[model samples]
Target: MTSRSHSLRDAIEEQIAVGELRPGQHLDETELATRFGVSRTPIREALIQLASMGLVVIRPRRGAVVAEIAPQQLVEMFEVMAELEAMCGRLAARRMFTEEHAQLQAAHDACREAREAVDSDEYYYRNEAFHEQIYAGSHNAFLAEQARNLHRRLRPYRRLQLRVRDRVATSFSEHQEIVDAIVAGDGERTAALLRDHIMIQGQRFADLIASLAHLSNKAA
Candidate 1:
């Protein structure tokens, strides 16, 4: 893809992740092109990319619109994601090198700073980096790739979850435990922590649904 297309994809993806672009909202290529000062080609390309990532849907005649995932489907996806992350953490605990552990600590520290600043966007970015370190540290190329693909697919929902009250702070605290487990080379503990960290359940699941409903109402 051209630089323009790549930038356009990122821009659209961010908007969707941040809830500025609501699920099921139409993505008019011409409007996007005008808004971004680009041609329809790039906008089309961007939407196509988003579709492949499960963030958008291209209808037969309705053109492109943001993808609408059912609540149960979302839950199912998270369940699978939690398992994938747990496996990564388990392997990472046993296989990560000394330098990799240092890098993970650095990422965790960055997340701490973002949490202290109470900047959800910054924390979200750092949080992604922190998890990515574990994925890479797993030393399983295929598993890492699978985790990454699912991570990308769920990016929007994950970002939205941080908007819930006190979630960012709680998430950082959980990360502390996760980091401690991994650094201690406790594979089972790391796996359990990672699974719980990635799973959306109970109040968090309720909050996510509420947030999605609010966004849907606004779109309506």
Candidate 2:
């Protein structure tokens, strides 16, 4: 991707992730081009890229809009994400090198700082870094690529999950447990923790939905 298209993609994705661009919300090519000070060509390219990433939809006659995932689809996506994360954790626990472990530790420390400051956005980015480190530590390049692709697709929903009451602190604690298990080379324990960490079922799912609704209301 060209630098302009890449930046435009990032900007649009950020808006969607933060709920500024609601699901099914229309994305006017000309408006976005004007807003971003770029030509319609780059905007169209960015929308096409986002569509491939499952973050946007391109209809034959209606143009592009943010992707609207159904609740069932959301559950299914999270289910798959949980398993992928578990697989990564398992491999990472066994295959992680000394330097990778050190990097994971540092990322964990940053998460702790974000939690201490009660900074959900900071925690969100650090949390992403922490998980990406685990994916990299897995040492299976193909598996890591698949896992990262799914991670990107679920980025918005996962980020919204952090907005649930007290979830940031709870997530940080879980990260601590995961870090300890990985450092001890306990593959099974790390895998189990990772699965639980990403799977938002029952009350957790309800809570995530509620948080998203609250954010949507505010955005409106």
Give TM-scores for every candidate, taking all chains together and pairing residue i with residue i. 0.95, 0.97
Model 1 lDDT on a 0 to 1 scale: 0.93
lDDT tens digits, residue span 4-49, model 2: 9989999999898777788879999999999999899999999999
| Each prediction's RMSD to truth | 1.3, 1.1
lDDT agreement with native, every candidate:
0.93, 0.92
Candidate 2 structure lDDT: 0.92
Query: Cα deviation in Å at residue 216, candidate 2?
Result: 3.3
What lDDT tens digits, residue by residue, belong to model 1 across residues 26-130? Answer: 999999999999889989998888888888999988899989889999999999999999999999999999999999999999999999999998999999999
Residue-pair clashes per prediction, in order, are: 0, 0
Residue pairs in candidate 1 whose N, alpha carbon or C atoms collide under 3 angstroms: none
